[model samples]
Target: MPINLPNNQARDDVLAGRPALWLNPNLKQDGIWDTKLPVRPSRVSEAESNWMLIASLLEKCFPELKATGGKIESALIEVSPMREALGYSSSEFGRIFVKADNDLPVAGSIQARGGVYEVFMYAKALAESQGIISSEKEVDRLVSEEANALFSKHTIAVGSTGNLSLSVGIAARALGFQAVVHICSEAKDWKVDRLTRLGVKVVRHNADYSGAIDLARAQAEADINTYFIDNERSQTLFFGYSAAANELASQLSKAHITVDDNHPLFVYLPCGIGGAPGGASYGLKAIFGNAAHTFFVEPVQSPSALVHMMSGSSEQVSVYDAGMNNKTEADAIAVPRMSEFVAEVMKPLLSGVFTVVDDDLFRWLWIAQTQQSIRLEPSATAGFAGPKFIVNSPQGHAYLEQHGLREKIANATHVVWTTGGAFVPEEQFTKFMERGASLVKDS
Candidate 1:
């Protein structure tokens, strides 16, 4: 069977690498769990339990975790100033909040949610197999000299454009494991420098993200001591990210926000290969059911998830197949293709996807800093345009009417998940700010 996308301008725009919105025609309001999903909701609680078990070891490894008592979590900030700067009134777009993962403790990005958790999961499994620790007790002895010797024999490896490498490398090294990161040409110099400073082996590839991942997987398969963190098909990574929804639920309760039918919730996440956003959307759907609407935001030139999902193909599809160049300044999310595991899991759960131009990302980055004192990378700022796209576009309005949510718009809750930037060097961040400022002035 041939894959048939919608014969419309939106499809044409996506193929041309222009900004557009593509709603999931197969999005379901019920029976989401009827399909065999890749990661189950029960695994989310398991991941939470795993985090608690390793909390002590994390605190022992990083002094920064002492403030949060070894909890790797971020704040949910209500963004009144930034919302206003974006030209949206509360009545028009409801309440807007920034899930400030950029300020998260470990990797300073959303990758901290999955990348760190997956590394911890691996460390725990390795220890259990060696009889170094038991599930009944805390992992206090993980930093012992004997345990470190055991970890030294193994290597944790992954392929990334940038942020995931930082998250995995930092966590693996902190746990006394040898860490190797295979990064693509698009990866930023600052990320490579950070990994090198952490004593992580950095393998530079002159190819794209998929090529780097291919090389990493092949090398890991050949080495008995190397454990590859497969971004494209890791159930551990998916569940690790899904666990974040529990934290979001608790934060929403504390903030006195409602997400019932009368008060819909809309979450906009910046997507790369789609593991983080796909896991997040799946978790949100499990918690809020029909009340939560989750969308993935991507760069126009690298709409990997959007293009693949829109095609409705069982085989993996790359943005290049749709005539996109797979080029963008949002290097962190410059993925040519999305994870097939994520696509299958999100086919029913995801509400929609939208694309943004690079210029708009910079403009939003400037607004986030000047208006709210929130620092973020270009990729992190992708979600800032989500609310506007949903409220103003024809497809967005049609979606609301189709779902009987037009009247519920004023009572909705919008969350823009900010992905990364806390560890950005002063000089690099200064350059980002300068470019953003120039874009803002010209606009």
Candidate 2:
């Protein structure tokens, strides 16, 4: 399983089904990451716009967020036990907080951010166009029969491994839109069944995530009334994901955590098609400037984003370009290719990227639950290795020195964004736990 691809040979090895840990050498230290806000705000500002719609939708549709005053946010907890178990010193690595998006309400994943937002976007447009709701004052009427009737005429379609489909389907069904989730074969059966139980149409494909998306896109294009939530190239999804930064900023401020020159903030996000992590990184950089050091974690078999960014191209690229067949237990992040748009957006922003094998994912999953009571799906455990990877790698040490962050390591706060698994069936979770535990014992 050892990957030793050097330079141009990486493309060949990746195509042959080998895994790699690729670092971007064309990284630019431009002051863009430090900018308070991008000029157009298409990514950040529109995200705020969508956030308001999310609030409205939640207020009228989901009773849970309504109970919480229409706010959609998750916990940022300190897992000192897990941190210590990972051999990260509190004195040297500062505090470690797990942004528990895995336990998020409703769909229970990071996809709850963008996935639901995209659904709401399509719903809002349809409802407004049909005169179902006239103004902001009438937003609460989104759950009305009139709105539902208008929505039933159209459909919201998306291709997902699991979590994103749950969010999209849940949101779409809530507003009376016909939810169609085209899922890859690797997605969990429980997820598909759950969506089906909610009256969402579950279309199964034997191909991978990309194949499912391509099929869904084709189907949606054939019908004008169908809106495809394109995971690979959706600006709406990107904006929705970016809104997390504002929420995190408020949480950090409330906890009296300083994110500045002397106290850096490091975020490790697990990457799939790159929208979630890419948008999150962009927003963090916008908020904290250079003080925010963002890294993306990928499964070794599908380090698509890393490969794309390393190539430094505007054209599309796939992990298969280097011989990777894109197979991993982390189904949610098993995408073969990265989003070109997201890659371009994240090019100058990401501090580094690394890969963790499936064995490590299982080991970390067991460790997290047994030691910290933080149970995560296999894919969610991908970020757990981020801190260790950076601390041990030559590239990471050099990055710290280059950024003048060597001395500031003690004050740095590392946040591993847990992406999914709150609603995983007990049976399925137990199986994952058992597999992880067995792997840990063997290792």
Candidate 3:
């Protein structure tokens, strides 16, 4: 049955998570993507310092990272071939880049940046107060018996669909914190079992991501010893994610890619509740100013952030309100509701948002693997459709004309931020790939 909703037609359509493109009418006119950053650069720098500590800790504690000399950051692999397969023209889109946070070390997703950072921030603060880690060198203390004992006295908890839980649970358990992950019902069983094997408490909820988050918040409030990693409202998480822009900027500079009035940059990020994309967009805006056009991509079944921003409802409206189930194979980004904090911050920072159907994700996944030797999970593949949509879609053309971006289109650089996939169990990833292959064969 089609959903009969009680909003205006546009709002109803958005809430239903129909595949669509929406330009932010509230985007600042005089300075494109030039808004006051939600968080300060100093705060972002602090998060970077924490990552340095984490790097040191990994060197001393984990043999795997230590063997690689503790190189914690993932590469921004260039995938111009993948872009060509996706129908991006080199003459029009200039070039295509892929920021492969999908291959991030440890937790193997973009969430590793924020999720692990939040856990580290919490653990570091508690340890510093107890004089357990007085210096960066003492970061190794986290893996020590005494520090583990201290961490065991505190509990770290979060709610996630999958990726964020892997990051938080793995890091928290490594540091000996009693980690509790409240997972949405749709989360893969492999993720749950992996966390359980790490000795983290995995609590499964028979509801959507929002419901799981609500329950996790209540539980954290009930226990003083429990420190909740608030995905929706954590500035720490946002700043941790914001740090990526600096690294990306360096990469672009090294490649001789310029972002200016003539050479514009377009970034496509896959979004869920919007923390990671929002933070990254904020940082990119700060770095590239008017030269960067940032857009978020979402699954058609759960375009939570776009629907909220477009309708001006923020957290008050959900996909369910439009009679949508918020179900999709992109489990990591299957959020029903947008984070109010991110929605506010993203209003001025984003260029636009677009939603893609599950079939589109699978098609691109197949194309990427066969044509470009690149493989990504369904959620990560959301950004693969961005360049084509921005250049070819009617709504996209209108947006460019309205924003005076038509002239710069020829010199635009598109970057697709692939969010997560590396840690997916081989069998699970094979299943995703098989589905993608079958879809391609049928087509």
Candidate 4:
């Protein structure tokens, strides 16, 4: 099948690395809430249960988890100050909140939700299969010497541009499992150094994220003792991310927020290969149904999910095929291609995707830091553009009118899911702040 995009303009804009918004024409209001998808909402409950089972082990291993009793979660904070700084009043963009995954415990990034959960799930399964801990009561024995020895005989592997590697490597090493991270060239030196310091083997790749993942998967397949956490097709990883929706639902309820027909909910997630955002969108749709509209944010040069989904093709497509260089300051999400599994799952669920330039990301980063004291990396700030696109753009107005949401604009709730930055080194963070300040001044 050919890559048939809806418009030549969008194709050209994407190829030229110019920011663009691509809405999903295949988005369905009905039947998209099906529980039989590749990763179901019910699996989210199971993932939550699994997290509880390993709570004790996580607490023993990671000091950060001690305060939360081993629960991997982040705050849903109201960013009124930051929202005002963006120059949008309440009536135009509604109440804005930031899903602060940047400050998540342990991994200090959104990958803590998926990458850490996947590692924990694998360890629990391996222990149970080997009769090391047959019951939930004995699950704490996973940290014991006997279980450590068994875990030492095996390895957990993943390929990432940055954050996922940190989450997976940190969790795997904590459980005494040998960890191997195949990192792409775009991955930051700080992330690589962090992983190496944790005693994890770092395999550097000269290619992009997809290439690193391919080589990692192939290498892991040859070694029976090694388990590859495939970001492209792993249901475990997807389910791990889906559980965050449940957390968000609870938070919304506690905050006296109402998400209904009149008071709609809009969530903007920063996307990479699409696993994190796709899983979160799926879970959100399952809980809030048509009331929740989810959008994915991507770098202008690395809009892998946008390009592939916009093409309306099941066949995997790369940004390179569209003449994109896939280079961006948002290193973590500089993916050449998206996860095919995620594209298929999001076909009917995703509302749309929008691209952001690196400069805007820097400007938003500066605003977030100065106004609300929120520290975020370039990739994480991509979601800040979501509310403006939804409220101010012509395409956005059309979508709202089509969905009868034009009258409901004032009552909407918007959440910008920030992905990472907590673990950014002080010097690197200073550099980010400087660049952001310069960009803000020039703007």
Candidate 5:
């Protein structure tokens, strides 16, 4: 009788169809259950999890999300030989395969950690809920003078199906704004000619990626200084991707790594518009509150948040082949329906993983290019080969022997999160050749 959602007979047994998410129930291990709260602010500081208190809450509340890599606390650490070729025996995989920052600036897809703080805090909360006040002190004096407001008021709007809409159209042209991407004509005229060479304004829309977010919400309701920064239906893009789950819990506490709640942990995120695992499962359940085990991957021709979790309905997340509905080469975990906050927090805190084994994600991208040469494409090793293809299938080894995960899959030390990088340096030999086969189209 529990089902959830303020249970009026579990909201009429979820509109009379039932399956109100695994028929609710489990989640009571001893803590956090006050009718199952959304709580998470005691004594605070989940190491300011998604980092720099979300880049100082988009430079003091959305001053036109401009950037030339001004904030991001270290992101490259699969240290050394791709951490022994994804054997990943902890040591937080040496600060998660960090590079020398190899300067493409707003490039290396983790969608610039929440697409440049949800387009500078949702364009300063829609300019203080549309009153404006000298455009919110010229967006707080162009974000306390970090400058680069590229002749300012650039007018923000994003609709992405790839790398957070080309990393919020290069952070709205490094903060002066003026982006307009709205994808889904099966994008990739080389990422729409690299978002019109970062001047942005690429609008395609045959519909997929929710019909390029319904033409970017009808061009943000016919523009009033456009600010529709929806990376799948923003909670300000999970307050800017909870800063990559606060940089994976501050690099797993600088590799001291201690997972509690009966040693709980599991993350195989790769969902479209589900902003990098719904802000890394709300900052790892606000730091392991009920332990945590989030999974959300979809690519069997865009299952669309697994058909809106077997159909609970707020309708949106189906793929009717606008060109085989952006045929999953796994453009950084293709998204369509997002912001039901990952279907109400991955329904009872997580467990949904699917990967249509593109020959086991291009054989784990040529076994990370012959063990740690690190080529990684095939959607950057599908979140590190989606928990080693669900612990080697047969219903993922019988749900890992009814949930023990067979000694962490015989001590592989489970942590497969290589969620894409090395953008287009031969995108894993052109994600199985197309231009080499004359830009596909039997249609």
Candidate 6:
């Protein structure tokens, strides 16, 4: 609660998504990363070795979330139709495509997986610290009974770019918590209204995602009873996302992809608030050690993280642990600040580099449609945009050759991670289904 939450006056009129005449910074030669984040110790821990934390998750978080039934549902497709242009399929690897059915989720956001687990984890931890439980398990079971019994009595708050925030509201409601999602005015009014109808207290902040986050964080600090489930910064949230990577690795096993030492994986993943990649990177590296390589992708327009990486003031890859700032977006992946862990725990994960892509987001959408058969939102495309830009660039092409990046991925598999926008309305879907097709007549 350092800075005051600006009044709601004229906040409703804040124009977002438009390019501003802000001071521009150099985009190459470690400019963004070096300027924004100075190197720090990695906060990520190695696999299964952190039993105390794992046990805490079981005792404090999962128990309640499990009791509520699967709040984080999965949606699966036979293959992403959009993958057609890219030329890949589940059939390529011999009929092995066991994956999380993300389309089955209520909000079409995988963040639901982490959000629910985070709430109970916080509750369990708070209770334990307050002497409600001498150990993690007591709080774990108590969280289940307590969450189910009076979930509605408590209020949960989150700041998101549609998916992550929406997931928090839906999961909170199911678990009996009064959900509140704070969003920037630049977000689609339709999505904001939908949240309101769901009984989620949707607060439209004058600023972008980062501004809303500042508001949410301040509010959470002031009110003890108000539980905040930050998909952006909390330690528990990382563990939650690690589950997704774990499941993905399990699926890769069915494809005969040996995830062993020397056969390490070079995963190019999406970053939004740096939660998924940070947590997943930590998890993969922990379990696989030298057997895994993870590359984080950010949007060129929203290079807050890259900026931090280059700056000397910050300790990690993001500013979340410190605070938030004015934010820009590719929408879904827009975040002004990031979890401090990205600097500390997730810092050692510099095994791979970070890259941003051009604005061919919609093209990637069509690519998703034609190739993998999944219609991802523009923000989702931001993830793919990174690798696409690299492979397409002359310098990047040379770098790839120099680093042997083009080496035919041996038993190598890639997950583009179409991260959000799974539930586009019928009108939107119709538009997506016919995005770039030409009419033909054979008279």
TM-scores of the candidates are 0.98, 0.93, 0.92, 0.97, 0.31, 0.70
Instruction: List runs of model 3 lying over 4 Å from the truth.
Output: 1-17, 29-38, 67-71, 135-138
Q: Backbone clashes in each candidate structure, one number apiece? A: 0, 9, 0, 0, 21, 55
lDDT of 4 by residue, 157-231 (tens): 999998999999999999999999999999999999999999999999988899999999999999999999999
- Once model 6 is optimally superposed onto the true structure by TM-score, how far is the C-alpha of residue 152 displaced, in angstroms? 3.2
For residues 1-443, write the lDDT of model 1, one tens digit per residue: 23467797679878777778889988987777887776677777887888787788789888999998888899999999777678776577999999999898889998998999999888878888899887647477778887789999999999999899999999999888999999999999999999999999999999899989999999999999999999999989888888788889889999999999999999999999999998778788888998999999999989989989999988888888887888899998999899999998889889889999999888888899998899999999899888887889887898899889898888889999998999999899999999999998987
Q: Which candidate is the best by TM-score?
A: 1
Note the Cα lDDT for every prediction shown.
0.89, 0.80, 0.81, 0.89, 0.54, 0.53
Model 6 lDDT, residue 401, Cα: 54
**Which lDDT tens digits does candidate 3 get at residues 309-404?**
876653456776656678899999999888888888878778888888999888877776677666577898899878887888787898778867
How big is the positional error of residue 284 in model 6, measured in Å on the Cα after superposition? 1.3
Candidate 6 per-residue lDDT over residues 184-298, each given as its tens digit:
7657665777778778999888876767888888988798778887655677667666666555665567556676532435555566677767766666665566455555665
Model 6 worst lDDT run, 10 consecutive residues: 18-27
The CA lDDT at 141 in model 3 is 73
| Candidate 2: pairs in clash | 11-322, 13-322, 14-322, 14-323, 14-324, 15-322, 15-323, 16-323, 17-323
Name the runs in model 6 displaced over 4 angstroms.
1-84, 87-104, 123-149, 260-264, 312-329, 351-359, 386-411, 431-443
Task: Note each model's CA RMSD in angstroms.
Answer: 1.4, 3.2, 3.0, 1.5, 21.5, 9.1
lDDT measured at residue 118 in model 3 versus the true structure, 0 to 100: 86
Winner by lDDT between candidate 2 and candidate 1: 1
Candidates sorted by lDDT, best first:
1, 4, 3, 2, 5, 6
Q: TM-score for model 1?
A: 0.98
Q: After superposition, how far is residue 402 of candidate 1 from its true place, in Å?
A: 1.4
Which residue pairs clash within candidate 3? Answer: none
Model 6's TM-score against the true structure: 0.70
- The list of candidate 4 runs beyond 4 A from truth reads 8-12, 34-36
Q: lDDT per residue, candidate 2, 1-443, as tens digits?
A: 22333464334444444333355554556767454432334468677766775586586677888766676788898878777667785477788899989888878899988988888777777777878778866766677888888888888999989999999999999888998999998898999999999999999999888899999999999999889999998988888889898889888999999999899988999999998998888888878877888888888788888777776656676777756778899988999888877777776677877777888778877788899787788898787776665566566677778888878777888899988888889898898889888987786
Q: After superposition, how far is residue 363 of candidate 5 from its true place, in Å?
A: 34
